[model samples]
Target: MPPPSAPDCYRVPTTPSSGEFRDRGSKFVAVLRPVRSEAEALAVVEEQRLAHPKCNHHCYAYRIGPGTDRWRANDDGEPSGTAGKPILGQIDKEGLSDLIIVVSRYFGGTKLGTSGLITAYREAARLSLLETVLAERVLTSPILLEFGYALMTPVMGALSQLGLEMADQEFTERARIKLEVRQSEREATVKELKAAIAGVYLAEVHDTFVVEGLTVSLPG
Candidate 1:
């Protein structure tokens, strides 16, 4: 596991990808994508259904939010745990979240039974990941800092030392500055801010947001 000092990011697919597998006579096409919410994931599933209206089934699994706090797997008329579970297993195996994998099956007039179905779905999902591109998303926390005018020099020096730029600033009897700190830097940044302000200052850390397009390939 990456330490807290590491980038507070997670792995996710940046674009959609698909893979297929055949079993007996059935064709399974697995579509994998990153989705922001359960609503969006369901919408993608609907789109897949409409695009393949003739398919025998549309089994899927989706995990959303950090830690995969919300998730679901649907067998979609297939035997319990055969289709959806295996597909979800693939997603989990990749340590991915906020993603969906939907496998649409077109009956080829042969039944491979339960175990075969599981293998087909799992293989298709794995293949999708093989063709998928991955990215490390960066998370940012908004912080508000206020300090007495007397300490502007030290505060500015601290900001410079930390390579933190103010998102917004106000100067009056006291000064207030807003910043966007990476989640990984929050604790250390707070400590530095306190040290700089000394006797008089306020630093408020706010909710986090994803840094747009600020992606990297995290090292293992």
Candidate 2:
């Protein structure tokens, strides 16, 4: 049998999601938010801390970038490996990146043991992720084309035929257009466009990233 195909896309939360868990009168509130960078993740954690100043503990876990190399888990004041590890484990189990989860605990005049704390944190994180709407995003690279006005017809036609969308454009003595093509289609798109329009200048790729093309339809 042929080898299994590698994944070309990834799932990400469309918006912030929240969940709550209660045990032995203690309240655990989980907030899951999609973030692109470490700075953004830290900012969200700070925001949560400020919002719940009375909370006894504010523990968090975050994963950023395309792989697991960039990630962190903070136990805060909780016992070692009780809070943050469980929260991070949940994120890894869900196969999610570019996300941060904060679990704030308010002591309810009761002390839950280590096992209880772990279960509560993990379940809270799982519930928050379950409540999120996830989108499948594909990676893309941008190409900027600058050509003479004489090539307008062919240039526009080539873009339309390739089903590529122009991200930006400028009309001047020379027409300038920016296009984003899927990384896998980059070479083909450039070859087709160059063949259609002579003297089409291809600029360096300005940016490369992933984006959701359409909303996923969930089953009832």
Candidate 3:
């Protein structure tokens, strides 16, 4: 386990990589993808397992959130602590979060020494994380607003003025927009936005909804 008090930044790969090799006649193939949370990490692992049903081993690990959510790793059938921990350690070393990595081994006919196993797993994970495209640090906050096309221009303008990061905008009978307000300015900006379009808009906080893309929400 990495020191609990270790620094909080890590890197993760941006793209998936596949490599196949035979050790002593056994076939091994590794597939790695960046993942954000345990749920996402596990989902990818399961998906790959399903995709390669006959593979001998499917091991995975992931780190999510900020320092609050400590890194986690697992080795499916490799040594007890070998596969997952090393992969996760590399993530921590690279200061990465919200990423997942999985390695599949088919038990090559030749046994890779413990050291070989470690290197292969570590290299696979390292390469995967390295492929990722990273963004500068930005705090994200969730917000909901209700408006109509009658006020789209003003609403968008207010969004820019308030420096609120727009996430999702839905258009139907009503315009339902979601914002990822920067944490530092979220409260003040929300207030400012409300005030800016007070009479013209009907915005209110809504239940928390998690969607992909910069922002997304169902039109209200």
Predicted model with the maximum TM-score? 2
Q: What lDDT would each prediction earn against the true structure?
A: 0.79, 0.78, 0.64
Which stretches in model 1 have alpha-carbon errors above 4 Å? 1-7, 148-157, 167-175, 196-220
Q: Please list the residue runs of candidate 3 whose C-alpha ends up more than 4 Å from where it truly belongs after superposition.
A: 1-28, 68-71, 142-179, 187-220
Q: Return whichever of 2 and 3 wins on TM-score.
A: 2
- 106-208 per-residue lDDT for model 1 (tens digits): 9998888988999999998889888888776677777776666666777787788668898888888678788887788776666556544443333432223
Q: Which ten residues in a row have the lowest lDDT in candidate 1?
A: 210-219
User: Candidate 3, 37: how far from true, in Å?
Assistant: 4.1
lDDT, model 1, position 205: 24
The whole-model C-alpha lDDT of candidate 2 against the native structure comes to 0.78
Cα lDDT for residue 119, candidate 3: 72
In model 2, the clashing pairs are none
* Tens digits of lDDT, candidate 2, 66-167: 655999999899999999999999988877778999999988987899999999999989899889887756666777777766667777877776677888
Clashes of 3: 25
What value does the lDDT take at residue 103 in candidate 2?
Answer: 96
TM-score of 1: 0.77
Query: Which model, 1 or 3, shows the larger TM-score?
Result: 1
